[model samples]
Target: MAARYLVSPRGGRRAYPDITSALRAAEARGRAALIEIAPGHYEEALTVRGEIRLAAAEGPGSVLVSRPRGAVLDAFGAVSVHGLTLAGRDAAVDIVGCHTGTLTLDRTEIRAHDGVAVHGRPHTSVTLRDSVVLYGRTVFTGSAGLIERCRFTDAANNAIAAIEGARVTVRGSRIEGSRIHGLRVCDAQAEIVGCEVTGTGQAAVVADTRGELAVTECAISATHAEGILFIEQSRGSVDRTTVTDALHGIVTKSGAGPVVRGSVFADCRDTGINVQDAGLGTFENCRVTHARNVAVFSTKGGAPEVRDCLVSGGNVGIAVTEGGRGRFARIGVEDLAGTALRVYDEASAAFEDVRVERCPAGLEARGNGGTTAEVTGAVFRDISLGAVAIDGQSRVTLRNVTAERGVMGFAVSGEAMLQVTDSEVAGVSGGGFAALGSGRLVARNITVTGSEGLGAFGTGSAYVDITDGTFTDCAVAASFDEKAAGRLVDCVVNGTSGVAVRHNGLVDLVSLRTSLPVVRHKEKPAAPPQIVQVLNNPVFNGPVFNGPVHDVQLAWNNGHVVQQQTEGDGTHP
Candidate 1:
């Protein structure tokens, strides 16, 4: 029953006036053909080889197949184009050579004034269901396609392009207003499901070079650039995608590697997941909101692997600069205006179970001296400033960390190097672990509670070494000013309302136990011996222990007056 042919410009006698004489009287009645086209304009420029079924008896813009120049349906093999309205200048549905059947364009209405508006080659097999491709660009070189529910509008270029070894599958498509890139895959292999790319001038899904993309549940919006763009050595996988108001949301650079899962980058103006240069990615369960800048930006030598993420209101949430390196697990950065995880130049990062809340600053490792940050089980809450801020010549390490209600909690300055173990600094207003300038702090079993100020601070030529420490209710529980140097072993300064150990400089107290009033020697006469070297058994009594002692030690077990002096000629013992 494949042999009906009736095309009319009213040339009667069983009607076959145009449509290339009704496809040459159905190819001399030698195979499959059904060319029923009756109503209106047909400027003729068709070359269908063999099995054809070109319908449009009166539906769909009432048949208008205009040519004016090259390609107006030049399909080979089994072609089926229903409800026609194909107009062209060059390529308005041109499925070239060596076609292995199938070139169906159901409910068609493709119109190109310049170039491509559906041009498939390389053993072509294209099927665009519920079609409506307008104004140029819809190329598929090594074709093998299926674009269902299609409607690519106002595209002068790239509103669907699958290069070289193309094998495309775009389902539920609706790409609108694309001047450039609303779906482009270079060394082709694409699978975009439930797509809805809107208002794109550039990059609303582009996988360059060795392209291979799979964007599922897609809904990319208003992209001027980058809403899923994997450059050069592209690799893919972006599931559950939803990128809104994008400038940059999902951009994996040069040596691209993508594995973005459960994505949702909202209100992005810049960087919501940009892994640069030697890019490599693995972002799982992502959700970056209000990204005005850096919600997840790994620069130059980017190495990303962010897991279980949720970054909110960004100015900077996850920024691994220049020589970037990342491995952030279980992240949750909230309400950031700035600095909530930024590892500067010569970068290196590794954070686990991270949580930074109400940020003004939390986790800022500065550059130059090769920055490095390693945090485990991190939690910095309501940080208004300094909740782990290590400066240049950086090297930071915190294990099982928690800095709560911070104004300052772990702020190590230049020539930096900090190592905090089993950390905890609660209710800080200022100084709950601060080592300035020539910074170097190594803490273990740390716990500084309710600090209104000073619960472990070292000034200028800073150097603090705290072991088995705990300073509770601190206003001043541990401070070493100006040419600073410190070492508090097995320390415990409990409920200090003021001065528990505030030496103007140099301090080394082992097994020092205090409940307020330990030492406060701010009188640095020509500075250099504001020393407080108290050995082993220390349970110092009030009177603000005016310092200047070399090796003082006191002992008195049970009743606990255990203070012992070894060699103290200059004062206070």
Candidate 2:
């Protein structure tokens, strides 16, 4: 067995001259040894071949180890170093190759000029506690490492990088001012907790390549790229974190699945949360704000779910496109310059209990073929162009929705289908509800009031079916073009305007009542060949029949009605 030795500049009978000589004598003994260095400066590189304990006699500042040529300490076997400061022109420490036991560093400080501070090789297990690495990066390849209570600063590249089967854990660490990612894990696994990472040129934390990374209780900000990036089939969990001032706060890319909870992402230059390329993201109790683009974006075949989230101050609050699918619940969006929620191009989504206010377009869905959306208990107020717009062969259903102060409250066009029930559209500058260009609408229990234009307008071969609704205070309550068709069943149209219902198209009126005169027949250049009838109904505020008079029972109808037009050129019945 080798005997422990102490090294000091003041030579004594039992003390060695330097750490190099002590290490030599210890290795020759063929056993474990402890070399205690006294307070002094040593300018030499020491490489260990066996188990050894090298420590400062007092504390970290008591002894200084500097090697101008190479690494200060290169350990091939089990080694423990404590309470020392190592400054190297090259690497400060390297733990390499087939460690039969554990390697540990405690209360140490390392300063590297050109090379990395700490490098771990394959088949090594290393641990660092209460350490500081300055001006260099740390790389762990195929090694299992643990880092705790450490501070890393001013790295030219990634502060900590784990690659190729490395398993690393970092806790209670502060990493700052890195040129690239603060912590990067590729083809490896990592767990980071209670860490603060800031001022990175790239993503603050990157997890890629089938790796599992868990980050909790962390603060990441001021990153040029995403604050947290999960890509290339990586799986991760991020919780209780605050990320701000990044291009994107959190991004899931290319088949990644990440669950984020209890987080706040604010003031991002781009989207606050972005999921793309078939990535699946789940966010709960998250708040995102002040994004320049879409606040939460799921596109390029991604699917995301957001619950209890608040998104505000963006061009679009949430956008799902390019075959994306999402579900949002209890979402509140306000003050958007563009559409609050947009689903387009074969995308589909469901929104419940959503509230949108002060947006140019509240909810818009446009698609070429296979887009669909369902919204329940949604309220939109103070919009510009329109509150809800559905177009391009898409379909949307809105229930218990309320819209106020918009141009066209609900606009449907281009063969789209919209069903609105238990909804209200009020204070609209244009038509309260419009169906244009082969669009279809099926509405029940809907109310429209205070529209400057017609309350309901259907044109260009559009179809509208009102099951039970009311329209008031508009130029014309219901107006349909010649090519359009609709039916009003158990509905009421009342307005201060002289005309309540005007239709050049075919409108089936069943139990329909109006407070203003109904224009049964429009005055065309010539009376149409078809015979029109004027009903003698008392529910109308004005005359029910205006065109012509026919047989008494034929003039009015529920079961039987007469068809006659006083203007000539049409046959009377």
For model 2, the superposed segments whose C-alpha errors exceed 4 Å read 1-4, 10-13, 28-34, 49-51, 76-78, 89-100, 450-452, 472-475, 494-498, 520-522, 526-573
**Cα RMSD to the true fold for all candidates:** 15.5, 10.3
The lDDT of each candidate is: 0.85, 0.86
lDDT of 1 at 259: 93
Considering only N, C-alpha and C atoms within 3 Å, which residue pairs clash in candidate 1? 553-563, 553-564, 553-565, 554-562, 554-563, 554-564, 555-563
Best by TM-score: 2
Kindly give the stretch of ten consecutive residues in candidate 1 with the minimal lDDT sum: 524-533
Q: Give a tens-digit lDDT track for model 2, residues 1-573.
A: 546889998998889989999999988987899899999998878777688888899888788888776678777677888988878765434412223456787888877766577877788888889998887788888899899999999887789999999999999999999888899999999989999999998999999998788999999999889999999999989999999899999999798888999998999999999998898889999989888888999998888899999998878899999999899999999988788999999998999999998999989999976899999999999988888999999999999999999788888999999999999999998888889999999999999988888888799899989888898887778889868899988988876665778887488878888868877665465443454444555686334555776434333344564444553555552
Cα lDDT tens digits for candidate 1, 110-227: 8886667777788688888998888677777898988899898878888888999989899998998888888899999989998899888988888989899999998999888888
- Ten-residue stretch with the least lDDT total in model 2: 91-100
TM agreement with the true structure for every prediction:
0.44, 0.85
Given candidate 1, what's the lDDT at residue 357? 95
